[model samples]
Target: MAYTSLYRRYRPDTFRDVIGQEHIVRTLVNQIKSGNIGHAYLFTGTRGTGKTSVAKIFSRAVNCLHPVDGSPCGKCEVCLELALSGNFDILEIDAASNNSVDQIRELTDKINFPPTIGRYKVYIVDEVHMLSKSAHNALLKTLEEPPEHAIFILATTEVHAIPATILSRCLRFDFRLVPTSAIAARIRFIFDEIGVEYEEQAVNMIAAAGQGSVRDALSIADMCVSFCAGNVTYDGVMEVLGTSDPVKLVGFVGNILSGNVDEALKTVAEMCDSGKSMAILASDVAALLRNAIYVKTCETAAEILSLPEEQCAALRALGEKHSVQKMLSVLKTMTATEGEFRYSTQHRILFESAVISAATEAPAAGTTAKERELEQKIAQLERKVQALAKPGFKSAPAKEDAVQVWARVASELQKKGAAFIALAATEAEVESDGGVFRVKVGSSSCMKILTDKSNRDLLNEAFSSVCGQKLVIEEVKKLDEDKSLPYITSMFGKYLEIK
Candidate 1:
């Protein structure tokens, strides 16, 4: 016998064998049992979620001379006849290749003909969204009023592309992604039937790599069966997936979370030397961090993750040692690197940079960690001052000097939670002119902050509180000569004589 791929060989032939779409199955089963089948049906979902498979099964069930619980009895004459490859009752159309108006017209023209061996002539159109606009228009009329003996089943991954007219006329059933646990169990059953020796962790790993697609998971299992020569191990599955060993990944991420840049880089170099793709490495590291977070927070982490006991224990231990924020930060960096890899040729360099950035707690552009720390400290001090300077307290006497009054205004601004404005005010020169406070700032950045409407309002309120009277505040640009040596010497007088 010729060889067959695992996915194709294990494809579900009946509704009972389908997984992870019980809602759709139940409704369809009830429809079949109640003899309430619709003329037009739409099955929509991601690829490998069994939309097409279920469509085929539903077609057979409707035409079956004997249906056992809404599924076709394969032994019946109608079911056996429809099972043939050349069955005239069931027609499978690939809209991707025949997506023309003429093709759709031809299909519609054939709608008048009844089924050769069954009650309904079922038309299964895969990738129906690929049809052009005119093709959709051509099919719309027939779909709206098809013959009683005709059943139309349209399957598409992108249902948004389908016309609303077609959607409104059809009974739409959304197929959901199969759960990881269900896929894992299916893999175990297949492995046992195929006589393949495997580790439980290996099955879970393959199922997870499927990302909720049964066909994708089985395809991966096929590759694993071939590569492992009938014995699938966890490490073998990791190699097939181009992912790092769980132990090594745990250690590598541990180094990163602990801010050990040197050790983390060494681990990266080692993985690169082993021929691991940098993109996959980043993805695997991110997945590990996400799993660790789940393990730490979720009560049903082991069940949700579907990880083996040993790996779960290791992840639990790792999660206990690191904070979720730190892990999420690193995971964000890794995810960004994965996206950047598509645009850059230097994957290794990008991955290493991300690792270093995550490890070192890289500050924002043009700002050092020390500067951020100082800003934070200033904010804390401002909060403490505001808490101490509550209402109903006696106000301090108004100062006479312009500089002293400006200092009091700045203090008042800090109490009002304008710390940045207060800091900028320290670098500005203030003067009293006609009972108005004139502020002169040399730096354009400082001027920008003081001139903002909200900040200006804050300054006005602060000046009123400090000066014991409401005053109009005006922003003024300092003269160039104000920075000259002569001007400075005159302002300082004999207290600071020029050399």
Candidate 2:
């Protein structure tokens, strides 16, 4: 016998054999059992989620002379013919190749005829979304009122591309990606049944790499079976799949959190040296970061992290130490660099740069506790300063308007050698108590600079000497809503009203 790939060899013969889409399986099986099969059916989902497989099984179940509870007996002539030979009644068309209107019209012309040998003539159109506009229109009419003996099953990974008119004519069933645990268990069983020895970790690593595609996982396992000479190991599978080392990813994340740029770069360099694609590694890291963020925010091992119990606990602890925003920050950095890594000649350098941006960058506003507290403090100071500048800002002059206040702040900042900080603090209010003058800086960056001990003291001494009294320093944050400025020249006009 010729060699068959693992996916084909282990193809589900019955609904019970299909993994990770139980709800869909149950409904289709029930339909077959009740003799309520629809003429037009659509199976839509990502690749390798069993869309094609389910369609084949459904065909066999409907045509089988002896179907055992909605399952093909596999012994009947119809089941045998459908599974082995090219049955005229069950035509599997590659819509990708025959996507033109002529091919569709031909298909429509044949649909009116009765099944030559079976109860129903099934037209399995894989990747039906590839059909052109005219082709869609041609098929739409037939699909709207398919013959009694005709059944249409359209499958596509991209459903949105299919027109609503075409979608409306069929009974659509969506297939979800099979879960990792289920895939891993199935892989383990397949290996054992084939008398191949494999490690549990190796199985898990394969399952994770599969990304919820059972066919893809099986294909990978097939490669592993051959590479390891029927005795699969983690190292052999990783080498075959060209996947990044989990240990390297773990170390890379740790180095980033500890702010060790050099160490992180070294790990990235090693992965590059191992002949691993930086783009692949970056993607895996991003996924791991997402999981960590989920673990951190949810704090429930059972619901969030998919790792083993011990691994989940470790991830939960890491999540507790880092804020969700921080995790998201890192995740975004990795995501942004994924495309860069794909295009970069110096991948190591690009990966390192991405890591640095993620680790040190501040979390988004209102996300972290520390950031929110700082933001609140800055906001309160801004409100106070703005109130001072409004018409009834104080109902008393006491000397400076917005201009003089700004000038005082600029001069003090200059004296303190904080030129940049002072330059940015272009707008502010100055209040005088005897010889002491207080500056309410108008910008967050300016306020940050003013809060520095060196700048604060310098501003106090400079303003105090000018006023001939000790000056006190104060900072106010800028506000989001702009207030109308009440000019000191029109002060009396506003003041009388204020009184």
Taking every candidate in turn, the Cα RMSD to the unseen true structure, in Å, is 24.3, 23.1
TM-score of 1: 0.65
TM-score of 2: 0.65
Q: Can you write out model 1's per-residue Cα lDDT over 1-499, one digit (the tens) per residue?
A: 9889998889888889999999999999999999998999999987888999999999999999889999998989999898888776787776665324333334443556677898998989888776555456555766766779988899987665677899999999988767778899999999999999999989988987776778888999999999999999998898787667888889999999888999999999998998988987887887788678777766666654556567789998987777666776898788667657877999899999999999998423443577457545644543343333311111111111355466667777877889889877766655554445666664555777887888988887888777653354444432233233332232112333233
| Clash statistics: count for each candidate | 0, 4
How many residue pairs of model 1 clash at the backbone?
A: 0
Candidate 1, which ten residues in sequence have the lowest lDDT sum?
Answer: 391-400
lDDT of 2 at 134: 47
Give the lDDT of residue 438 in candidate 2: 60
Q: Model 2, poorest ten-residue lDDT window?
A: 483-492
Output the lDDT of residue 32, model 1: 92
